[model samples]
Target: MKAWLILLGAMGACAMLTLAYQAGEGVAEHRCEVARAVAKDAARSEAERRDGESAAGTAQLHDNLGTQLPAMEAEAHAATERIRTIYVEAPVSGVCTRPDGVQAELDAARARANAAAARGL
Candidate 1:
């Protein structure tokens, strides 16, 4: 009779231990799931912040280009007009010979070209 009581007590202890272990596993799993969700939320917020900053930078670049383009265009137009005026005012001559200054300019341009070619430009 005493041996039977001892065997029953041992079985009861084992049952309690099994139940405790299962409850501990369940709590650990729930905590892990909560941690994963928090991490995902943090990553999403960071990505959104970086995207917002990138969008703002792009907008700023567009605004700068919009303000500067008309000024650049006007300068280019003025340069073109100056070049046209120079060509129009020059006298037309029957002689094929170029003036001394023009010849010097041509020589300099040829030298620059030769130098650039030497450098494989």
Candidate 2:
């Protein structure tokens, strides 16, 4: 009878230990889930902040362009008017020769374009 009682007590202790281990596992899983949710929230918040900053920068660029456009348009109109006033001499013969300074002007324009490209503009 004593041996039977000892065996039953051992079995009960093992059952209790099993229950405790299962409860610990459940708690660990819950903590991992909570951590994952917090990390996701942090990542979402960072993305929203970056998007807001980008939008502000875009708005500022548009404002700057809006302020500058009228001056640029006026300059273009003046240049066009000057071009209309210039008089070119007629060719002496039916055959036309290339105009003087055309090549130099083309070279200068090309240099300016290259400089702008090098400056990333």
Relative to the true structure, how large is the alpha-carbon lDDT of every model?
Answer: 0.88, 0.85
Model 2 RMSD vs true structure: 10.2
Give model 2's TM-score versus the native structure.
Answer: 0.54
For model 1, residues 1-121, the per-residue Cα lDDT tens digits are 9999999999999999999999999999999999999999999999999999999999999999999999999999999888756553443466454666885676688789889999999
How far in Å is the alpha carbon of 117 misplaced in model 2?
Answer: 26
Clashing residue pairs in all predictions, respectively, total 0, 0
Q: What is the lDDT of residue 23 in candidate 2?
A: 100
Model 1 spans with C-alpha error above 4 angstroms:
69-121
Per-model TM-score, in order, reads 0.55, 0.54
Task: List pairs with backbone clashes in candidate 1.
Answer: none
In angstroms, the error of model 2 at 42 is: 1.4
